[model samples]
Target: MELIERIRLHAARSPDSTALEWPGGTIGYAGLAAEIERLAAELRGRGISTLAISLGNGPAWAMLDLAALHAGLCLVPLPPFFSEGQMRHALKLSGAQALVTDQAVVLRERLDLPEPMGSWRVAGRPLSWIDLPGDPQAVPAGVRKLTFTSGTTGEPKGVMLGWNHMEPVVRSLADAAGVTPSDRHLVLTPLSVLLENIAGIYTALWSGATAIVPGCPEVGLIGSSRLDTAAMTLALDRFRATSAIFSPQTLQGLVEAIESGLPRPAAFRFGAVGGAPVPPRLLERAAALELPVYEGYGLSECASVVCLNTPGHNRPGSTGRPLPHVRLRIAADGEVLIAGPGFTGYLGEEPPAGEWWASGDIGRLDPDGFLHLEGRRRNVFITTFGRNLAPEWVEGELTLEPAIAQAALFGEGRPWNTAVVVPAPGADATAVAAAIARSNLNLPDYAQVSRWIAAEGPFTPANGQLTGTGRVRRAAVQGHYQQQIERLYQ
Candidate 1:
């Protein structure tokens, strides 16, 4: 539960062993822990007992985050891609005055940042004076990190993750995923998502595995300096990476790596996917390609994972069974409800106006006892043809390939589904569409994507298409492609 203690233990046990990796590079436990202590001392002189981090996936970002904990400052990760509009909203909402960010443009263009300390820039320029001082100390028992629930109606609600909330969940996953001290596991998702924090960081480091952060922007998200196929392959090769956690989107990159003749490390042993429902087709291709991908499910409230399919216990379409300590129930309406370690709902919000948490997701368990997630209650749509549909069902099937990076299917009052997709960087539109067509062969006519369009670019969070948790804003997606949808139908 003590942040500094965990790092100290890792540092003492294997001072020379690599503890974590980022796009800018790797850090040995001794060095990282030392830096945390040094950074803590620097922060202490500034009289700041709290920190708000606004960086992305890399060594610097992770260092700032973990160092803040060791420094005993209440930590808050400012989702790096929030628009000025959203940033101001979050700032006002959280009352965070000090921030550490990687955005040069925001500083140069906006002209509104706290007083500059020394000199700083993201991509280049200068940010608010960058001199701060603090000493690393054990965080007291209370709120540690404030993670937000992506907006449902309007302003996002902040969820306070008490210091101990993630320790158990991270440990459970490390146990379930078979993480070991010698392994080097790639950290893929953005920091805003709990998956990367719990499964990617805590679990990997807890098991004494080297948590590798890609040094490039492409390896993790659209523009991440720490991630890319080549970087991932090189890191896996260079570090002898043993495992990873990915979303379906991230797995698509793995498919590309295979196709590009990027060698999959024989040491690579485990991988699991979630964030959204993963199609069976995607799993099949991942398996065939030797990526060892397994599908799973979780939410931010659960601190990342509750149920996951592991190597030998794999189920293709299901999210798989819950971890031993998690209990699950399917409400009469078919929504999945869970009670387990690691979960605490939004801090300021009342639990649905009363007691038990009602996940807005609708799902059911098969008679065979495996869990099957249906669509989100807010997302199910009835078509113009009077056919009710789960858009994610069709969209998930389309994203099974190495080409489709993102997809959205909507046609609430239309005869059939209309999909708007973003293809992988260089994939041809016609070819990608054909692949989707081929994948849809088994779906009923009503459920099939009757028309589809591909965009040349992927959506960015700044444009408001993605949430901090990396979920698509379906309405924003639909609105962005409105004219294109009309063109497809006509």
Candidate 2:
């Protein structure tokens, strides 16, 4: 069944059950259904077919998203972290006919867009509608949603997905995570990202659970990459969240807070960590702190999660077995390929000419059927001595040491591997050097870090060295530290 039908069923079956929770408010299932229907009617009245939603996480955002589906309008979600250029590119590329946003004036000033066509109130917030120019971009038939991937540089590409591509994944995720009506799923990541949108909120709603939707600041997100741990703890405690989706860096911060004596939420049942490669030690630390963290693997092209580790069926180092709906196979060259109903196609791009989507991640399926990912195929670097190394493999080992906070290995065509190390606070050069030495002991000689230089500071989105999701932008880092890396080689 469709997501809209599920919402209606929840309303009919349990009218008084809370469907969504935000700061200072809660909307029950009946009330949520009413609001969705009301807004959907308003959207249809306005003849909104291709609508763009550019708002922060809240009840209105949730309402409009579902309302669009009910209204039979093609929806495009705009990530708040996107640059003005990216926003413009997305608006034009997706051919959004109208935009619904809370900060219309701000966005207009930032993007130099025209004045709003009009305004309307939904869920008690005044939202403006800006009419876009030209005909809407032609998308493949059956495309109901257009979600853009968060790229490291340049404008992100839009991935078109329909109900057929999304609903099954949501159902499979709810099953794999054991989501039930008792689960209070917290929305920590932005709902614009397909990961949080599908696996977090959509799955929770499908399971008839309460979804706690709060603004990013309320959940400890200061900007794109930085997180405020105290705020996060407070939000988790406030909502009594049973499940949440987190990026690896955010999980690390939460783990550190718990280790430093912050109260861990006893009600927290499951935490899905993904969006980047997670170090196995981090998972071990989280387990030690009594935090149930399950690492997963996914891509925007695949409509979010392809494989996930869950409580009863988890391998610490492997991204768990593929979900029931998807088929996983390892290519002869070691690329992870997914064969499933997911991934309709990319907007303005030809569909890949194959039954399987090459995930571009190099991985191996263990005898137990768990998928163990090494690194991105494009991220593998060959040393001057003919030794091939995946930098993430080495970096993952380096970060296992307590003193080494971050490591960016760069040695393509160089004699030996070296890194720019970001040391943990109060760590001295000797300590960082010792940590590198300890990490090298665990790695093969060819992949070991032979030399290193201390990073002047942390890799963050503000510095353009990290993506919004907190993955290191290796090209940016390489360019920023070219002198240091060259000096190490010399």
Highest TM-score model number:
2
Highest lDDT model number:
2
Clashes of 2: 0
Candidate 1 per-residue lDDT over residues 214-331, each given as its tens digit: 5335453455212366665555566666787776666766776776888876788888888877778777777788777788888777666878888867777888888875778888
Q: Candidate 2 on 130-178: residue-level lDDT in tens?
A: 8887355455556778998766654578898888889888999999999
| Candidate 2: stretches off by over 4 Å | 400-405, 423-435, 454-458, 461-464
Q: Model 1 residue 123 lDDT?
A: 22
C-alpha local distance difference test of each model: 0.69, 0.86
Model 2's TM-score against the true structure: 0.94
